[model samples]
Target chain A: MIKKIFSLIIIAGLLTVFIPIILNFSFQTDLPDVAKSYVEKGSKDLGAMNIVTAIIVTFRGLDTLGEVAVLFIAATGIAVLFRKNAINDKRPKQISKRDSSEILLTGIRLLAPVILIFGIYIFLNGHLSPGGGFQGGAVIATVVLLLFLSDSSYKINHKIFGFIESFSGVSYVIIGFLGLVLMGADNFLDNRILPLGEFGTILSAGAIPIIYTLVGLKVGTELASVLDNMKGDIE
Target chain B: MTDVFIIVLGLVMIVFAILALYLKDLVASVIAAGVLSLFASILYLIMQAPDVAMTEAAIGAGLLTMIFLLAIKKTKQIEDPND
Candidate 1:
């Protein structure tokens, strides 16, 4: 009875909220003033075909940096929470390669490389395409998750993980620091330092793609590490 | 026409969300949540926000579901409705 009542109330609330969206009449079609200027000027100023990437990696770089820091903190927290259990356990529990079907293994071998290439392509073309660092990085993390799903005992090298994770984080800051030094502290994360090649290309967008690539590596490694710890805790 | 598709997808999302809440098995609930994310991503795509759709599909459906499943593996594999 309580479940029925609760569900009914929730459904009613959702319907009320979604009615406008369902009608599609309340959806704003015109771009706001700030967004209008961004779309108009962003392509020429930032040399990024994807104005969203320009907004995220250039205009709001400090915000993106802060966001990445928040993600890093969350990753650190998860690591710390599961640290003891992860360390004490030397071996993976109840996992056997033989337990998985041969077909799955064959599929993984054939599909893993494609997924990886796709993820790299997503990040590499972030300036010109819909994908950016966070999206691509998450896609890359899926590769590790896929491996874990197939074989719980799949081991990722801690050394490589740590290197990729830390290097990306440090390089992000280093690039920002370069901006501060070269273009003044107020200009931290400015994209004008490097040559902004042709627009709508992989090599364009100055530092946006580089920053996004670093962001992807950091996010991907961080998530993979978190998943690793959780997998460790499972008996 | 697009509205019809949007409404249908939205309904599917709500249904999956309800199924997630109603399910007894923790893993099933997590899978339901993944399906919900998938629908949400499709909605984003239909709305022309491809970046958001990609992120939702990858992180929401893929990464989060795996995390939840691992958490379920670590904790109670099954939920007890009775206190």
Candidate 2:
């Protein structure tokens, strides 16, 4: 009771500190100078329908690359930690996973394909939509999670995942370097290496779709591997 | 109208956050946290940030919840008072 009351008092104190700030917060009515420029010229310069995608993929592309690298490191860390446990426990223990309900199994069977297609669509049309590689990759990872839940014996091929991850990461960096080689230092990760097709179409947006596709694949594989690690050793 | 919706969502999120903090059942706490993420995503949508909303919903609500559940499965289902 004392703990609960103390927590409540803390919450009340936080509210007291924050409520005035919230009340006084005024929403920005106009874009700042940098934002104004991006909003005005982003679509024309980057050939992406979604300005947010244009900014993330081209205007600040290097940051996104760093973000992907961070995710890779995190996934690698999980794999390393779990690998240590697997090596330490040489005894094979009996693993028991409860059988999923019929409803869940049937639902997953029907929904998996649709979810897969949706994830692909999200990344493929990232340059034109609100979702990009990270979101789509996460959606794809959820499918892996679903499969794990539904089938206890299901195993992911680590070799294939590793290949996909390395291939995508390498290709992404190569494409970024291609922009530098073709244009200049200022054009690193520039999408203009390929022709920027019609503005709002799927084939448009120059290399944005390709970059996002690679990002999506790398992110999906990394997340799946993390999930696989957490699933523990089945054998 | 949008302000009202945002305010309601914020209140609900706070309620869930507190519930998550206080819940004894680990699964219930995880679910509460997930619900907070779901509400946050909705708030993001209302604020005209669809990209952030999608990422938050997929990652915060879905994957994080699943990870927490998996961790719980590997451990205990209830919060121990002493430990």
Candidate 3:
């Protein structure tokens, strides 16, 4: 059944790719004039050097909220599956007992902090630059993965991770609601409610940077925790 | 320069994608698929679409590869091509 499904998918994908070429569909080269004008105007207003960041944080903030919720749901699903099997299964025995080279491990230790700092920097400047919460969070998790591989004994503090994950997730929503009351906005994540500081400043983009930072923290911590927890099971 | 790089990168990505599809070992195939995604990101950069490139790198190379590796660990390896 799986192989048949894969074959059908391949056939459908090939048909779509080939049919588009055979029919010669003309793709639009430019955005609508109204959208282009608004983009030009909004780029400056939003204080984002990267137009994509502006669209993500401001124009499409609600979609981002949904994406984060999806992440939370996935994490919960994994948690549920593991919790049910936790008591029945013994912790996986560590495989490949070969010791890592001290030099390689040292290099990883040195690099981990730099990667984490870079992720944080990206999250903090998300409103002003190209990087944002999701990217930064992934980067941070990459650092954790590096640590896990280079040092098998490395373990995450589950309590700290749980606290950080929950706090960041809750704070993200709270920040949005705060925007309603503090800025007297009618909606949850209205940027017009927050003080849009001087253009191009780190403090600019109203509540966007703060929100992204929270998202970054939540994602990074949760992903790292997931990967860390998987360590005991991959044997 | 960019156009030439893009053309070459696209070719490389296509090649890797084919390898990923045809390879016998599931783990190797997954890794090859990830390399294909990395090449796709390079093509995107050559085409001046960093945002898409970033997404491709993250979702395709990072997340997808990790998921495949986990799934492969859970399932029994295929012994015969038919089996």
Best by TM-score: 2
Docking class of 3: acceptable
Candidate 3, residues A105-222: lDDT per residue as tens digits?
9999889999889989988987666678888888888888888788877888889989998998888777778767876656667665567788888988677788888889998887
Off by over 4 Å in 2: A1-24, A84-88, A96-107
Q: For candidate 2, what is the DockQ?
A: 0.73
- Candidate 1: which pairs clash? none
Q: Write the per-residue lDDT of candidate 3 for residues B1-83, one digit (tens) a residue.
A: 86687777778888888988888888988999999888887777776777778767876689668767766776644536775
Ten consecutive residues with minimal summed lDDT in candidate 2 chain A? Answer: A82-91
- Best candidate per lDDT, number? 2
Alpha-carbon runs more than 4 Å astray in model 1: A1-25, A85-98
List lDDT for all candidates, in order.
0.87, 0.91, 0.78
Per residue, candidate 1 scores C-alpha lDDT tens digits across A158-215 of 9999999999999999998888888786988988778889877778878888999999
Separately for all candidates shown, the number of backbone clashes (residues 3 or more apart, or on different chains) is: 0, 0, 0
Worst 10 contiguous positions by lDDT, candidate 3 chain B: B71-80
Chain A TM-score across all models, in listed order: 0.83, 0.87, 0.83
Output the better candidate (2/3) by DockQ. 2
- What's each prediction's TM-score? 0.87, 0.91, 0.85
Give the number of the best model, judged by DockQ.
Answer: 1
Model 2, residue A49: C-alpha shift (Å): 1.1
> DockQ: which is higher, 1 or 3?
1
